[model samples]
Target chain A: MGREMDQEPSVRTDQQLIEDVRNGDRSSYSELVKRHQKGLLRLSMRFMKDLDLSQDIVQEAFIKAYEKLNLFEGRSSFKSWLFQIAVNVARNKLRENRYHFSDIDDVEIGVNATAESSLIDHAVGNILQKEVDQLPFKQKTALVLRVYEDLSFAEIAEIMQCPYDTAKANYRHALLKLKEVFQTRADLHTWAPETNGMFNEMNAKFAEAAE
Target chain B: MTQKRFYADVLLKQTLKKEDRVRIPTDESFYEAMNNKIMMAIESSEVAPGNKWEKPWVFLEPGIELNEGAGNLRSRLSSKSK
Candidate 1:
């Protein structure tokens, strides 16, 4: 009996776990938490950037999802619904806190810097973070879901509570904006041979948008 | 449908991937402790009247320590439940 109880509950689907929880089996909720917590934490970290706050967001998301478990009509996947809850919680936290980022100007690149150097990589990363943080909230959210979470536009729309086209456009706009920022950095020219090709394509796209 | 590829997408993805490798921690113990805290919070809260839902708690206020679960588990499980 102890061995049976100790066996991993991952064999059961999330929906099955939901049913068990609804039937007053609180242990099933623990399984559900175990299954989704890591993913939820990663998603939350994309928004909050602070691990402690991200963990709090994940905890709050799970608790809220459980408290409102009765209301889940199963239209969307449980994962999608849970993510929507976490995104909302993270957004509210952002609104309350008003996160600040360091100025892009603060990242100084040495003339002798190479892509191989950790210093160059760190500086480039700082620049990327600053640019991403500067993006409009909706665009940033769409980009994060698409790029980091690897979620489809349909899923991104469901989570963002926006239309499918809107989500795609937000992601597109984010990439274009980031590309525009990168174009101004001559230091990044040495990063890759593909950099020039990317710049040419981005230039064409920018011209087409202009026309 | 074949999606149109953006040149910048590759670079952005690469940069973000490298950055995320450092930012997101993969320690199992950290997650285990977080899960314990969540379960403890859920276990301690009271279920609202006529509904099986427990009152939602505020987690972010000052003095609300994470591991201690000392935050007020106030009932925000009103119409927001839907």
Candidate 2:
């Protein structure tokens, strides 16, 4: 279903594709864009919450990356470097829109009774996305990169320009904050089966924290 | 463990699961448009070499090829003859 699927066993790595682009192979840049656009678009959606803006962010990030291709010294994996650029672009857009993540207490859930009812009546996923959007920006980015993109903490740190421990802490804080919000809402348990073994694991953690 | 704590923990995991299930739908049109936009930007900046956007070097003659070695030599000889 993808170019990667049709690609031979000896398909070039991202670094190889990047080298080709640097050597004036424009089609290689298209390959690089195809390899990364979906995930990067999702990442931007996490920040901007709008499809058009996310698409713009991804487009700008790719263009900027292409224009500054020479500056890429391969200090990290190409994906991490690309994520770094996307994050910077997302942050700039946030600033332009006057969005700031001040504190955990400042985070506000958009789920009122009407919203929750509409979501529960329709899709539970939207409810969770709204909750995620309410998270502090750093925590949300950490959680999304870890859970959605499945990137390592080292990569998250490089993208976020923070220490590795800070990235881990941000993820931990994000989960805890979401937990705190859900404790009062009994409606979420209906979706428990979907979590597979996560509920049991979480219960064990809860017991440990109490002890 | 407090019953309340357990409930919250479980609920959090449920929400995370739901989040994971969430997928924003995009179509081929979006990707194609983005490809066109990027290609347009790249093509427009061809004069800058290396895909960077910069003012193209002004040349004394339209057909003159700015070969690095030859251009340097021509500049040096012209200055000496001046």
Candidate 3:
């Protein structure tokens, strides 16, 4: 009961947070950073699987975001805006590691977090995420933007600087590849499980982060 | 991994949470640093581009004369050893 009561204003509207941040409320910046850091981290993980490097990219992205906050025109959703920045940062890092690249976009792959089975499943999921990370840069970008960002092919096209059809095709190819990888794995399961209403839960939590 | 979504779900919840009420800091360092960096960047930009040659060490191939001298050094060393 108290949980729901406390969550009411934390994930306040993005515009409100932006306004407060613009007014020199550093706490708002903190709130925004706290609210979005994980997503940015996970998104960066998509490009560079190394947790440390992704952290660096996420930090740099946030600093850049704060510096450029006034330039935001609100055309895109705040998620998309921040994501575009993180994606840019991740891509730059990937470019730097041209020889040693690995996919770290570790999606939840659907195991229960506390279940004993969750550990075994997470290991397998980590392996699969690494494989997904190895695809051509464009394909990896399309896949992550689709699955993690929840953006449509058209939206991905814009972020990826590619045509809509090309983006759609890349997602289809990437998913099919993942499905194939899952089928090949002898890990007692044959596919990636669905994560229903994942973003809804994210939205709820986001609302609670509002200060 | 679908579990990734769950982790992200958990993390997003954790991040949005406020730790302590009224934790705002009353300080001046943040503003000062931001101003300093902005000023430094502006100062660098005001120097017109292509107005002056960059320092020679910035060259990727070393200067053409340096490359020629390097070749001369190699040849001179080889000839002396012979």
Top of the candidates by lDDT? 1
Docking class of 1: incorrect
Q: How many backbone clashes does candidate 2 have?
A: 0
TM-scores, one per candidate:
0.74, 0.67, 0.50
lDDT of 1: 0.69
| Candidate 2 colliding pairs | none
lDDT values, one for every candidate: 0.69, 0.66, 0.54
Model 2 spans with C-alpha error above 4 angstroms: A1-10, A99-127, A186-208, B1-14, B20-22, B46-82
**lDDT, candidate 3, A1-211, per-residue tens:** 7998899687475667877877756566656665566667677765776666766777777776676676554544456567767888887876777637433343445456566455554455456556666677777787667655556554465456556678778876765565444335444242223223333444443344421
- Those runs of model 3 whose alpha carbons end farther than 4 Å from true positions after fitting are A1-11, A99-127, A161-163, A179-211, B1-82
DockQ of 3: 0.02
Across residues B1-82, which tens digit of lDDT does each residue of candidate 2 receive?
Answer: 4676656544565546555643555787877777778777777553224434542222122122222211222333344366
Which window of ten consecutive residues has the lowest lDDT sum in model 1 chain B?
B68-77
Candidate 1 lDDT at A132 equals 85
Write the residue-wise lDDT of candidate 1 on A112-190 in tens digits.
Answer: 6354466655666777787788898899989887778776666677678777778789998998788777667675655
DockQ, cand. 2: 0.08
Q: Alpha-carbon interface RMSD of model 1?
A: 11.9
